[model samples]
Target: MDIVSHLNDRLLFAVPKKGRLYQQCVDLLKGADIKFNRSNRLDIALCTNLPIALVFLPAADIPRFVGEGRVSLGITGQDQVAEAGISVDEVCNLGFGSCKLQVEVPDQGQFTDPRQLIGKSIVTSFTNLATDYFRKLEAEETNGVGADEQTQSSKPLKTTIKYVGGSVEASCALGIADAVVDLVESGETMRAAGLKAIATIFETSAVLIASQHPTHKDLLELIVNRIKGVIAAGKYVLCNYNCPRSKLDSVLKITPGRRAPTISPLEEDDWVAVSSMVEKKRIAEVMDQLRNKGAEDILVFSISNCRV
Candidate 1:
């Protein structure tokens, strides 16, 4: 598991050490056929099959490392990238670990809109994003677009934003802030704490970020393409079937591949073979339609990975 002998010339890839995103990132790498041994208590690991060395770090810290060129690439939440306020090329959306950064207030409070809590105190782990949100509100107020213009015209709302490490939802109940901004995977946690979301600051999911100063452009592009291939492969399946020549056109419409369905001549001159890629989720419905349209010998098989 040392892998150090092959690590010196590899591109550094940072991923979350422990969190909701850690295992998902590992799965994505494996799906792309990047092999590595993740030994316990190891901060760094080498991808034996690729020119990449993975650095395990906090998800929140991934953005900074990539931005500073300390790591050539990383995977982290879009919200974290915004919070870090760094410049990095977003390669692609991984489409997992979806969540929302929201503004929540106590259930019994009189708050009905974001404008209602203008001058009130808010607490959150995302202090910078919270402050930036307030600044935008102030600018909107100056342009006469904010509600309660007359009251807010004289001076911008001096909203107080406090930073907390964790349990931001408890801040309101403990009188630390009038409202709290935090990540919400489900409304259950907020409901349990007697709080409700008043506004969603931003939506987020895991995304691949690449350094602007990449030293290994070719390797980076290869990994990115492999990941894209894995993601596309998961969403689709291969559908192969035979259809009478007269019904070939109709059946082809039912299972069109990325470009077009593959058609081949059959031993029976009046029949033809058709093969196409269909979405896995809609395979049942697609099969039914093809059968009704005179398709025969239909078969659907899973694809481990594909380029298109």
Candidate 2:
């Protein structure tokens, strides 16, 4: 059987084959307990424990596959989905691979604003987004003008947006383009290339997306919940402690969990034990606050996986 025939009964999940999000996606799958062994030089992987097949493709292509229903699910950057202009359901934010799509100019150039380079050439992989941004900018400039004047002012944007698969930053240095629109994570790479950001287009992060109509809707929900569990596990920890009855109200305020903290009476008079989930980043501060509130035996435990 060919690949399509093999996947006929399995839900197709598109993942980035190789890019900034590839490894993080793989780790997420592992954390969700989706067992699979990808063969050497093959783009497809069959899950051993589920009726799901992983289709390895470029991050830019995953959104198209999911949006078209060719793949039931996908993990990709929100910017890719926007650039594709595809209709799909955003399942949840995975909270990694965060970056911003920015309009940048040469650091030492006279152009300091995106509007300054409006009529200049821009090179970027996100051609559609770049074109739309510049078009909107031009429209904004003609906002208060008369209809005829606006029409005259909005002649085809003098700004030319050319698509370059890579090396977008080098376009300015090579004199082929006056500015570039690209993804910036730390701003280090752009600085190294002598480019500075003038305007931010949008912020994006890795997102789990699903087809508008999934063939295996039930299975897709199961997988989505599992992925959410993995994300929650990474973000929070279980906090346990004992507090006096008089301090219960004050202590609960410090560790207000997803819901209410679980409270159980202790054998000793006027004492209660509390268990709650706290953000991993704020655990130390929460512990200190609990201690100050007359709580004792405060302990933090890592969560491997959970439904909430």
Candidate 3:
């Protein structure tokens, strides 16, 4: 199809080639009905069903590409966006791959607060966020000092931030750093490495981001809406049931949907059919509640994709 030659005409969608979010991002695109094929040796794939090109790059590099307008859209971690310090518009939160960027010290260490690590050496991949956090703490400490004392001090001690591409947790044991700022999902890795989180710098999840100025705004919006629909489908389920007309008000209370429940007539007089979308996690309890409220023939359906 001469994909490379026609790339300029298609919207570029940067995706994580491999990492924690890679598989999930692939699943999201599939859910959105984006069809594509790649040789795997190639980093780019052209969607057969849409005028889009998926550029698989490192998750951390996505924000830079999208922010610089080199790509029209991307799915990457919120922490990556913050660390990149780029000016991309966050289209929507994908609500998966949730984690926290945190400050962690050795478990046996006396440091229990991020403030205690000021002026100490910290190793991290996220050099910018870590440096900014400690600098803010340093500024606060300086603000508390008397004006005369501040004048006498040579300068506020600067926190030493070292950039490590990986294995930040080993820095403390190796005597190279006092602590580390890293992403923690389950804390198992930190615990195994004899570390404990003192403070969370920020909680983050996968986010859909767009260039500040996209070449194809309409196409970008269409893909964004489709991805949002997939996210909504993952979090919710469609619930349908029949109930007495007199009990409709009560059933509505049990399943009060995102907006409102859909009601339909039934063959039996004084009876009605109801349909609503309920949170997937609470579907069990919702069904039980409806059954107790004189609802009958209850059913639940999984939503593959939805607009809302």
TM-scores for all predictions? 0.87, 0.94, 0.92
Error of 1 at 293 (Å): 3.7
Model 2: per-residue Cα lDDT at residue 130: 89
User: Can you give the lDDT of residue 269 in candidate 3?
Assistant: 94
Number of backbone collisions per candidate? 0, 0, 0
Model 2 clash count equals 0
User: What is the descending TM-score order?
Assistant: 2, 3, 1
Worst lDDT run of 10 residues, candidate 3, spans 145-154
Shift in Å, residue 136, candidate 3: 1.7
Residue 59, candidate 3: Cα error in Å is 1.3
- RMSD (Å) per prediction: 3.6, 2.4, 3.2
**Local distance difference test, per candidate?**
0.88, 0.91, 0.90
List residue ranges in candidate 3 displaced over 4 A: 1-3, 144-157
Q: What's the C-alpha lDDT at position 99 in model 1? A: 96
| Winner by TM-score | 2
TM-score, model 2 to reference: 0.94
Which regions of candidate 2 fall more than 4 Å away from where they truly are? 1-3, 144-155
Best by lDDT: 2
Instruction: Estimate the TM-score for candidate 1.
Output: 0.87
